[model samples]
Target: MPLSDLRFLALNAWLKRIFNADVTPTLISGDASFRRYFRVQHKDISYIVMDSPPELIKVLPFVNLANAYSDKGVDVPQVIEVNAEDGFLLLSDLGDIQLLSVLNSDNVYAYYRDALRLLDKVSLVIDNGESGLPLYDAAFVQLELDIFSDWLIKRHLVIELDEKTQNMLKTAFSFLIENVEAQPKVGMHRDYHSRNLMLQNEQLKVIDFQDAVLGPVTYDAVSLLRDCYVRWPDALVEQLMTQHFEQVKSSGQLDRGVSIATYTRWFDLMGLQRHIKAAGIFSRLKYRDDKPAYMADIPLTLEYIRDISARYPELEIFSAWIADSIIPAVEAKL
Candidate 1:
């Protein structure tokens, strides 16, 4: 169904049921998925209406995790009403200021300190087996990597790789998966970056968390520090990572045998893996989903891949391929 029909019927029905008033929804934003969020004004109050087609998007994970995170006192939206069959929900509004819009050099340290605190609290909740989220296992990691080759390389870049380059990517993929599996498993807000976080009333409210997973401990941290949407200096990135390391250690989430050096390496390698995956997702969003705005972010994502891959011996060949072949092709397209 078109968004108009969805808004008129399913959304109206949910709003009437919840508020008993006629409410007109204003479109907020849409993510990479089929889900779209809208803002509704009712009786001098604001609420968010989530339209997630039941066939393409499931509302249960978001609902369940919202409850779980709320129980742990994490800042998140409150579900006031839910219509599972229609895949519509009425939630408490968390305002519109994304962390990205306000993050700058002057306040980055303060803002990131708060982000790390929230992350540590969430990690504690997961460590206690309270999250009940799915695992981001080796198979899942490899599947994410495959999108880079399928969408970014072949579909977007239109570059056909030779047998040797293909084999090198395979090797790099395997090595990255091994690195991911070596870390301590914890709760990951799979897309925990600037865009998904809301600064509401001086507190950060986490949103778009339906993709929460039991994954590598460093994944979300990397997603925050080495964000694809916004880039920070290397020195500031390292400093923030060190701050997270101390917090994780105090939370007792860091593995006993993993030293700070080992953890930082894991963070860096995981960042490269995620940046590669993100570049492909952005390309797929552009070519397949007709969302070209994401194309603007591919260069930074690839830069992350190129810079980090060159520093490791195991990824020497992969780094060379990116520098010599991938970067030039992507740059020319941009």
Candidate 2:
């Protein structure tokens, strides 16, 4: 028997035992990770069942963060049941309408404001002693940056770097790591963006939060404002950025003495770092994971890196190299 069929049979038996009745789960979708989601109707109530392979991905972090974030008033999915050894979880359904489906020019600012307000609550939930979230330290940042070079540049694009080009990347990466370390550390929903946010009954519910970490305050803000899946005008982004800037300051998450200029620089460079990592992940999803649908999003990621890197004099060489070498290679590949 195929592995998928065996897993489905195990899931079905597990569900039957839990409900005391035979329940069939309909497939919803698979996410970036090694997990599959199913919608099951039992006693007229719909629930989401997650099938995470225990060997590949653990179910404890999701359980921990779900409980923690829920306590802090974030509308995450409620955990109903769990079989930790078998990697099965039953959760309350948050519905199918993602925040991305409803956002438009007319309502983006208002909707994003509510989303940003949610971040305030999320930031307050800090890491406790041992069982807390992991730190997004300097080494972590460098490892992510390396994915761009390893997957996109070398594996997918098959580009060989000379000594000078390697040195340029080293210098640029160091600058980004410094920017990450200089910011105020807070609880970050590392992949906080439009697609992960769901709108049900006019309330925003966050999902895909298993990878939360303790990182820079500006990281989540930039992830939302300069999203990989969507783009907004510079004027609108600047307005939203300033709004978040004041929000973090008022909440005492950021120092009041920090100027808008300094905050904006942090936001821009932080976005550059994220885009660099995203481009590589997209490529890896194509070649390594056999999920090529993300390749279409790679162009926007590179465009963000190019445009943002050009704004800083220290990154001038890096920016020019991207525009001259990387962009064209990606264009040819696509």
Best model number under TM-score: 2
For candidate 2, give the lDDT.
0.93
How do the residues 192-244 of candidate 1 rate in per-residue lDDT, one tens digit apiece? 88898999988999998888888999999999999998889999989999988
Winning model by lDDT? 2
Report, for every candidate in turn, its global Cα lDDT versus the true structure: 0.87, 0.93
Q: What lDDT is reached at residue 174 by model 1?
A: 97
TM-score of candidate 1 against the unseen true structure: 0.95
- Backbone clash count, each prediction separately: 0, 0
Candidate 1, residue 77: the lDDT equals 95
For model 1, give the 10-residue run with minimal summed lDDT: 123-132
* Per-model TM-score versus the true fold: 0.95, 0.97
For model 2, which pairs clash? none
Off by over 4 Å in 2: 1-4, 128-130
